[model samples]
Target: MAGAVTTVTTLSNEARPKHLTEPRPVRYLLIAVALLFIGIVVVLPMLTVLLEAFRKGWSAYIEALKDPDAMAALRLTLITALIAVPLNTIFGVAAAWAITKFKFRGKNLLVTLIDLPFAVSPVISGLVYILLFGAQGFFGPWLMDHDMKIVFATPGIVLATMFVTFPFVARELLPLMEAQGVQDEEAAVSLGSKGWRTFFKVTLPNIKWGLLYGIILCNARAMGEFGAVSVVSGHIRGETNTLPLHIEILYNEYQYTSSFAVASLLMLLAIITLVIKGLIEGKLARSRHGQ
Candidate 1:
């Protein structure tokens, strides 16, 4: 008994790692490489944006952001996100529910179609819209007769953003909802719960975190989207330009500091998105642990 107790104490006292630990030099080299990589890829660009934005002065930066064109871009971007994110959120939840809960033909094909935007180039996606709606394109004659504008307008911009952001929430929720199974939902139904009630009380609570995660990604993509929106937006100054497009216009017009100032807003938005997403993930982790 004493011998067993001594062995147990010795084992308990040993601070052995589960895997073979690297040498101090190797471990340090890995950490240095990671830090250097992050500095080069992430830190440097952010620092550059900040420095350039303030190069002229705080007054200059503020003035740049307050420009009429910049203000329009900001407003258009907010409106676009306001429309696009919620639309996609609803579609994502519905699509995820149907795809995860129902047995249907062409299921894999539906998933692939949902993810098709990711595989397609953004520039090409824009071109496809233009072809379908441009003045010389397929529906152009009919639209002209009706005096409808699709390409080079707000509608086109919203549509392009929608296409790109479509898959985010659905993809995030699918696996999670699948893992949760339908047991709870079926039980809810058997207990005389209505369909909407069953969904809100059972399904929504389970996937809300994943849904929020998807929304964050979708909002970021929608706001920062350039190539696709650019193709159809016509970059018509205060009329159609989104923030990224406005930054390009500023840069081309030789207003480098002001352009950087606008870019800084985008960077700030990205940081905020990341912070919120991290908080949501931390909460989810803690809730799972408590359960």
Candidate 2:
């Protein structure tokens, strides 16, 4: 048996194409190139943000964060994420469940719509809201008559955010839930579990990791979004400026140190998000292996 196994292994190795079976030196070269590319493109920029942020000193960094306008921007960003993330999470789970676990007409169209945000630019996403709610827009007169503001306001900001970050959770859950299929769900139903109970007890537990992963990515994008928010923000400093907008304002006004300082916060957020994502991925891999 051992001899047969060895022979098969050797034959499989020999059967691999030369290019597919990379030599030691070639593998090392490829790894080195990848590392170099990542260092220059990602690592270096992050380090620069940190270095420039602290260039003036720690006191300046703290002061930059403490500025009233910066504080407000932070608040608005948090509020936006708080509103957008949960709504998207619900929508994502529902959309994924519908598409993967059931047969329905226009399912392909629904899937395409979920990917619309990714295909469209963020700026365009924001502009879409403006066109729908701006002073001269179709609903502009109605909104004005009712004394309501949607464009260039917090509501508009949230709407634009929801539109752009729409795909993350659904995109993540779709493949995962599809791969999982409905066997477990059908089994749960057979065992006397009702619809919601089956979902909460079986479906949720199964897709929890992927769902969390998607939420993290969604939150990151929601917080980091600039283009769409920028168009509808009206640049109203404390009222509508998000962190990204605040950073741009500071930078354009020649406040390099403060701009980088604000940028550091975003950098830190991105780093934390990446760390959490990695941890979740590791846990997910372990869970799948165990299963």
Candidate 3:
């Protein structure tokens, strides 16, 4: 009887609404629209950056990159990202564990605070730090009295990057950790495993992909942060200027090729970010199905 029913179901499946690989007319229309939008919105700008960078030829592009200020800006950007990404990654993990593993008062409020950076403008993020640390500002006198400079220095830049990228890892991990449940962790505890050991051995493995996804996001934002970094960097030549600020300085100096060349580095970063995000997301999807 089961075989007979299966044969009947297979016979019904042999009928086609459309070919197995084919889309309906509506689907085709949607696919075309999506492609066209991507072309206009994403592809076009990227092409423009590449074109502008090489427009004045290889010598110009090389020269642009070789500029002392440009080199310094590039270094500063990388340094900021290195500092910000790790700190944020640790924070993200701790926040996710705390919020997802424990039942506590004001949990919702804590989650909202984690998302504060995403909701606030990057410009505002930078400005808030400046208000607190800028000369003639809140802590300005004390900081100056102690000869500590943050408002327009490396520390300020790092702080701004941190503020903007703060949410990425936590946001990425929260839902995933929640979905993963705490059963394994609880069991690990019952077996005499310590908290740190359980986290490193069990929780970390389960959430590795999500955590990496968040780290990538955090790194990208830290490197590309503009509005906030701009507000705080003070554009002091090589000393305080990050890449985005360097690009602005070049543009203002009428070094169009140099500006675009520097800008192209950021564009490449964005592309790499998208590619990595896609790969991680694919892995995540596969793992979900495997489970």
Candidate 4:
């Protein structure tokens, strides 16, 4: 029994310490560093904005919210997101379907082209639109001759946003569709269902959550877009201004409090989007389990 106890003790001593007892200091150091970084970078900046937004009291907050230009900017931002997100969602779904469900020549080339915008800078994208629609651009004179306006306008803003957000939904949907496979689609077709019917009934159900998630991402990007919008937008107040652009103008004019107020609103929107995305992913999980 003494020998047995000695052998067991020897084996236990030979084993390295488990995680709970091993290097407690290192774990605490890592956690301290992470907390310090979060406090300095994220928490401090957010608190500053919150304080600025409410500095003049609740009445000032209400006044800023009710400002006509602010209201208009908010409305325009929502409208542009509404239009752009849907268009991109449709394009994304179709592009994903073609890329994943079909085998064709130049397939790789086409996908590379579709993902091109992601590699390109937003400023470059804005420049491309300017070259296409600006006064001295290729189509500029012709468009002007017809009394058309694109640059420095709402249409230009939407187009720029759409360009930037084009990849979101397609990128999201492609993997999901590819993984789900063509078996269900083949089975549907075999049963005499038409292509569109099969897609809506069989394919869409499986990828709906993913599609919604992409749309949410697209919407957020559209609403918060600044660099490209600033390039094309003349920054016309209440006319062509988006919320982000409005915030920029406010800051440039030294209205720091108002700037952070609008920024806080946008931050709230971003948080809401995250919440929605979480809900969507949860629903998707439940759906897969149900299947």
List the pairs of residues colliding in candidate 3.
none
Q: Report the C-alpha lDDT of model 2 over 1-291, residue by residue, as the tens digit.
A: 111111101113245677777898987899899999999999999999999999999999999999999999999999999999999999999999999999989998988878888888888999999999999998999999999999889999999999998988888888778878899999999999999999999999998998998899899999999999999999999999999999999999999999999999999999999888877877666656555
Evaluation by lDDT, superior candidate among 3 and 4? 3
User: Which candidate wins on TM-score?
Assistant: 1
lDDT of 2 at 25: 94
Models ranked on lDDT: 2, 1, 3, 4
lDDT of each model, Cα atoms only?
0.86, 0.90, 0.86, 0.84
Q: Give one digit per residue, the lDDT tens place, for model 1 in 26-48.
A: 88899899999999999999999
Model 4 agreement with the true structure over 1-291: per-residue lDDT tens digits: 111111101113464557646487886899899999999998898889889999988888878878898999999899989999999999999999998998899988887777887777789878889999999999999999999999999899999999888888887787678778799999999999998999999999889988888888888888998888888888899999999999988889998878888888998988898788777876766665655
**For each candidate, what TM-score against the reference?**
0.92, 0.90, 0.90, 0.89
Model 4 earns a TM-score of 0.89
If the candidates were sorted by their TM-score against the true structure, best first, what order would they fall in? 1, 2, 3, 4
> Model 3, 93-133: lDDT tens per residue?
99999999999999999988787877788889999998999
Off by over 4 Å in 3: 1-28
Number of the predicted model whose lDDT against the real structure is largest: 2
